[model samples]
Target: MTSAAFDTSIEETVEALTGPWRQPRQMLHGQTYDSHASIHDDATAQKLGFKGGTIEGPTHFSQFAPLCERLWGKAWFETGCISAHYRAAAFEGEEVQAIVEKPADGGNYATIRMMKRDGTEVLRGSASIGIDAPASALDIRLTELKPLSDAVILRDIKLGMTTASQTVRMDFDQNMGELYPFSLEQKLKVITEPSPYYAPESAGSSPWGRAIIPMEMLSVLFQHGSKKDRLPVKGPSVGLFADQEIRLLRGPLFVGEDYRLDRQVVAMSGSKRTESLWVRTEVFDNSNAPVATMLLNLATLKESYASYDQEYAALPRS
Candidate 1:
């Protein structure tokens, strides 16, 4: 395009979001939490060192992307990248605050700071405004970066397969200008307009309530491996939540509740030439109660298919 077109798009971006927008409500309250447990679930708040299960760290950050889309438009997730520090822990049913400190946005570049309700810091994030084409990015169209050939699905996993020896604090569910109360109630009220798995009730919430953690965000809590590393049998990890077979082991994760996450590599199989990895993830609350679990599969696409360099360009100074 010409200089005029560039100027026009720039202007549009500045005036992109009219009225007011919110940081995701999901961040407001965390699920019940507990890191220490016997089998992932069926423990007590005493052993886990808390009253309930804590929210999955990865699940906490995923909320930002949607907020970015709301603030900057759909293009944000295209070239967007995010990373953060887990400041505090959220439990199954407690409400926290999620806030955004505006960025110094430039074409192809933007920065944002987010925090939680307990007066804690969360993430220092930036986006490269579509700088390098990512692996899933297509030259001619928007193609999902496929790192595997078929979706990997596993079953009957042992609990506690996924264990993290780390701790982080988080916040969310800012007062919503005092329009709402209890982030869970407020959040459950609203659903992604085009959600794939569930929907909102006329009350604008899901009776299902909140569980251990949303399965889609689980991929981040593990060692996803380097974008450059390729496994002959496993291949590199580039997959989406094709489907989930989630089970509620115990109760739901509520605010003030600590949580422990466990993962079981249920199974892995596909032609060596065909890349695929499947696993089952399980989560339990501090009481050692099975909060929720799921079976998710990721399909891999040949690495030779796309650009790896640009995809890592915006990955937050690793």
Candidate 2:
């Protein structure tokens, strides 16, 4: 028997769907660090005051998939965008649920939030369709982003500089080395939303005619495919994803397809405690066709790294 990809139950007044509570799977981070020792590593995280390696922020977006489909149907897959601000970290084995609120007038966007079973808010964001989505969580955050007043680690990254493109693909059975670096089967085992479509044999049942990559994994795809060594920012400074936005152009990106990734530094903004760089990455298929785009706000903690006052003082004044 073929199981449906998602729950199609639609409410009469405003559509609503509650996802199954899921625990954080550490597979993505494991792939991200190549099993290296880092903050994402369990022991490192414990030393930093976290219970364990925190799950990547994008993982929570999967809970909104079924909800977005119910509200906008297939269009959600074609042009849908989910912009979010991760408020708190969720440790491994902790269950969380996503709740989506649709406007009474049946608009193109909806308010969404993910919370732990105990009602602790994990993330808050919006899901919308089309190019003109209402100010999403990341959108609002971008507007509020201010230029750094002092010289910082990210001060050297210039806006509008495009990075070298790289080829990226996701295979259901193969462990994508460096790029994702994990097999699809591994991800499916602990994915927040388990669907038949995520499996190789049942992937044909999907609307995309094959296994469609989950929205969350797109972050991994972009990161590993982009040019990380060329960024001018000096590290050893702890950084975190402050906000993120993902949008597909043609439709759901399928698994096992090669896509070219090009990233551009769009903006640099910061706050009193942190400095950030906003990068927009565009994904193109083998045919040079545009597939999707992702915007990431990577924030560096100023307190974690040593102060640069001496370095700034030595530099010639602007």
Candidate 3:
């Protein structure tokens, strides 16, 4: 609620963490007319009933990095996985805290929650190491997903459609193109959690032998690359991340490493107000070894598009 709630002494404690964190919410945009023009802007988001531009859900994942490190140590950066469901929107300068519950078995898995200082839950999820661990928040949701029975905003996208394979790399000093639109140096200046591991000098000496990409930056590396226009999910409609999961299969992906990416539409579903497309993206090393996988749930708000009502009424029922 107040800045006083974020006491550094309390944050150093074992069970709790207090963060007066802020994110530059409006800066990131999707590759669409609506996403670039309105969805991520304050004035437009206000019209959609949100406080302001919603902070990208992946940005909050950075907040949990310290907690994960505390629980599982550096191995987390290599093999850790976080699966989360965005419960509510977070605006810039909104102080938030990540609370961690130690696993009963003293294992690598932990229950985690992010809440505003005023006690409003922003997201809920599970964090763990290893790919074979029990079902996490996103894992369970993946199983329960129902097929899209009615034509919604995403009706044009077919399940199993895949994005063309693309090559991607992250460099501590290079400027990433449109997908990221910023350099690592610029990102560090405003990053919510800054650590030496993200620096070239210090990180180069670590076991990874190079500046390891931060978990938050991994989203940029995986998403910000050249892609073939294939899936035709109507235009001028705004979409936001509803849920996300990142799993490191054989890494702490390093900066400046060449990695190949492939993504596929795995499922489609919708609610009264939104339609969603679930995609699974895989990353591979130069040797063709598996590196990491990202599961993203992109939800498009129905009200954002003017043709929703007429379009839905014309579709044949499943």
Q: Which candidate ranks first by lDDT, i.e. highest?
A: 3
Which portions of model 3 show Cα errors greater than 4 Å? 1-26, 29-35, 226-229
Ranking by TM-score: 3, 2, 1
Q: Write the per-residue lDDT of candidate 2 for residues 257-316, one digit (tens) a residue.
A: 888988888888877767888899999998898979899988776654555555556656
Residue-by-residue lDDT tens digits, candidate 3, 157-263:
88889888988888777777644567777777776776667777566456655677888788878877633435688867777788888999988998878999999
- Model 1 agreement with the true structure over 1-318: per-residue lDDT tens digits: 101101111112343321122233233222121112211122332233445434434444334444444544434422343333334444544443333333444344344344555555544434323435222111111122243222222122222344332221112332322111233334435422222212222212322232222222333322222121122323222232222232233322333244555544444433432233445545555556555444444333334223333443534542
Model 3: how far is 250 from its true place, Å?
0.9
Order of quality (lDDT)? 3, 2, 1
Error of 1 at 199 (Å): 6.9
Score residue 110 of candidate 2 by CA lDDT: 82
Select the stronger candidate by TM-score from 1 and 3: 3
Q: Which segments of candidate 2 are over 4 A away from where they belong?
A: 1-3, 7-16, 28-36, 47-49, 178-181, 227-229, 306-318
Against the unseen true structure, what C-alpha lDDT does each candidate score? Answer: 0.33, 0.75, 0.76
- Worst lDDT 10-window in candidate 3: 1-10
Local distance difference test, candidate 1: 0.33
